[model samples]
Target: MSELKKIPADIAELSFEAALKELEQIVERLDSGQVDLDQSIEIYTRGSLLKQHCEDKLRSAQEKIDKIVNQNGTLGTEPANVE
Candidate 1:
């Protein structure tokens, strides 16, 4: 691997879709076995970060949905008056 180049964008800054796309690309590259061990290690680290970011994004979305459901009384909390 030549000098283990840094990924240009911060993983946290990427939206969930972009991060997942990059992570998928990394998986493809690693699966192809074309990358050198050092490069693989570097990208693997980034992939893990992307995975965690994706998970965090999903968790946040779920929490928001749960709150909405609770407010609507779908999850057993008091329902907001609808009229």
Candidate 2:
């Protein structure tokens, strides 16, 4: 049997390398101005998605921080003291 692994494809799941590569290509295409009007719209749509993916990845990383706690009465971010 062959081994297979499942990987995330959400914008947040993209590696820094992959996202940067795609962003570079998008910039090149936008600069060339060779795409027909119809194609330009399509490329623009793709660029929007790539941008959003990168942003979502950053947001997810930030959310994972902010030590949330539920102690003594309420739930919210509170500094954790480890001893």
Candidate 3:
């Protein structure tokens, strides 16, 4: 059996350029509709995984944001700072 190249682990830390290129290929494959049902399903699954990976990365980065920090031990309003 051959190794499947679309594993989330492979793309979880991929650079934006690499991930976007792979995502584009998946979209092209899906758009062409030339693949069999199984292949289509696999492609769709991979696309979803890639989408989730991107979203996870975004969320992880967003988590570091300090939202309305009670800085100086005072309950004051402050803009969230994304570090």
Candidate 4:
């Protein structure tokens, strides 16, 4: 198995949608099996970073939403239901 490479610092600047789109593209490319082993490893590493970035974005958004819901208790919105 190939070792994972460090995530590029620029990846942090990408928006969640962009990262997700790139990750989806990576998945499709790997699924197609057209990529050479070396290229696949490189992309797979980057894809892992993108996946982590997307998850972090979602987690941040969820926290913000939960905070808003808590502050507006009158709305009676449950955080669990937001998901």
Candidate 5:
């Protein structure tokens, strides 16, 4: 019997680059059409999770960048007026 495949639950901990790399690999594999239907579904699910993780990491980084500011002639931080 084939073992059940599993997706990692710690995707949230992966860095932006790592998650993006995994997402790219999933895309390449799906594009190749080498996987069976079940495998395709599983991998597609994983890819979705990876995509969300990458997006969250990017948003967090953007927030940090927006927070950067200059105060009192010295480097400081303030909430950015992001629209």
Candidate 6:
């Protein structure tokens, strides 16, 4: 059986931009194929976690935007008839 490695808590706490940047770096390293098998697996796991973090951040931001739009009845700065 393979042991599951834990993702660092700090990664979850990172801003979406920061997490995406790290994920991009990981992709570059993986594409280069310079890492050993074990290192590749480890980084791949980290990249997955980072991807999830970025997605969650995006979702949260979208929810906030939706709330504001619903309250103001506008998609942008201008008011609109939602109905």
Which of the numbered candidates is closest to the native, going by highest TM-score? 4
Q: Which scores better on TM-score, 5 or 6?
A: 6
lDDT assessment of candidate 4: 0.82
lDDT of predicted model 1 = 0.78
Higher-ranked by TM-score: 3 or 4? 4
Write candidate 3's Cα lDDT for 1-83 as tens digits.
64344555677778655776777899999899899999999888878777666655555555544344576987555554443
Best by lDDT: 4
Model 2 agreement with the true structure over 1-83: per-residue lDDT tens digits: 64322323664466756875787798898889888889888777667667767666565555655445666677666553332
Tens digits of per-residue lDDT, candidate 4, 1-83, equal 86545557788899989899999999999999999999999999889989888877888887777666654446443464433
The local distance difference test score of model 5 is 0.79
* Tens-digit per-residue lDDT, 40-68, candidate 5: 99999899888777766677876887666
Give stretches of model 2 more than 4 Å off. Answer: 1-13, 68-83
| Per-candidate clashes, comma-separated | 0, 0, 0, 0, 0, 0
List clashing residue pairs in candidate 1: none
Candidate 5 off by > 4 Å: 1-8, 71-83
All predictions: root-mean-square deviation over Cα? 9.2, 10.5, 7.4, 4.1, 7.5, 6.9
Q: Predicted candidate 4: what Cα RMSD to the true structure?
A: 4.1
**Candidate 6 per-residue lDDT over residues 5-77, each given as its tens digit:** 4557999779889999999999999999899999999999899889878877787776666556643555553
Which parts of model 4 have CA positions greater than 4 angstroms off? 1-7, 70-77, 80-83
* lDDT over C-alpha atoms for residue 32 of model 1: 100
Where in model 3 is the C-alpha error above 4 Å?
Answer: 1-7, 65-83
Q: After superposition, how far is residue 16 of candidate 5 from its true place, in Å?
A: 0.7
How far is 76's C-alpha from truth in model 3 (Å)? 10
Q: Model 5, 67: alpha-carbon shift in Å?
A: 0.5
